[model samples]
Target: MTGPEHLSGTDRVAEVIKDIDADIIINIQGDEPMIDPAIVNQLIDTFEDGYVEMATVASTVIDNFDYVNPNSVKVMIDGNGFASAFRRETKDFEIGGYYRHVGMYGYRKEILLQFTKLDQTKNEATFNLEQLRAWTMEFQ
Candidate 1:
């Protein structure tokens, strides 16, 4: 077998999934070593329609008034459960009811490839979010 080539995390994942025939691909963060298996199952189970091109896990944000912390990424989901935006501050909703994005993602194989080809956006560079590059390209 060939040795692992040096690539960015997104590139590595995209390459691995390029030939997958699965209906859904789960993208979990490598840093989250202790992530619950139940959460993984939950994300997989959410693909009821088979049309969910992308999805992510989130939990109720319980942090008190400290929305400025860059470590916490706030998210707003539409009524259809699609993510509208992500940011460090509580932009659209009240801080108490915000949901913190869990960093795990689910996508179709085709979407994953498309994501890998997109260039990083200005906002993404500003926030240092690689995922934002994919998001900005409307891949998910």
Candidate 2:
């Protein structure tokens, strides 16, 4: 029942839940049907911190193929285990490693609504990652 006007999965989810009463919302991308439930639980638990407005999962990357694959998004984690950046591919001279970004997203209801209302950011368009849009807005 999703409309064609929605540009991203988050937008469609926002529309569907607009009338529902909920504090937290979880978004799982179509390509990630097989993702582990434990990860989803972990995402939900992140809301225990009032400071965490949004959260996503990331797993360690062990294989070289996934690291080089453009379809498998990579996440650079800061010292606090929060993602610093997301990218499809690594730079030639990049020194450190990155984790495989899980496709699921957890958002507070208010943040989800606000996020869908904003237009896409340039970094999001260039990287093809909705998370980038959220990240850019977090700082701005």
Per-candidate TM-scores read: 0.78, 0.92
List clash counts for every candidate, in order: 0, 0
lDDT of 2 at 58: 88
- Give lDDT for model 1: 0.72
Clashing pairs in 2: none
Looking at model 1, the pairs that clash are: none
The TM-score of predicted model 2 comes to 0.92
How far out, in Å, is residue 22 in model 2? 0.8
- lDDT of the candidates, in the order given: 0.72, 0.85
Residue lDDT tens for model 2, 68-119: 8899898888888777889998876653568888889988988899999999
- Per-residue lDDT of candidate 1, residues 1-140 (tens digit): 22275234666777877776786889887766777899999988887767676678887744655466778787767787777777776654465556777878887777777776766689877876666776677654
Which candidate leads in TM-score? 2
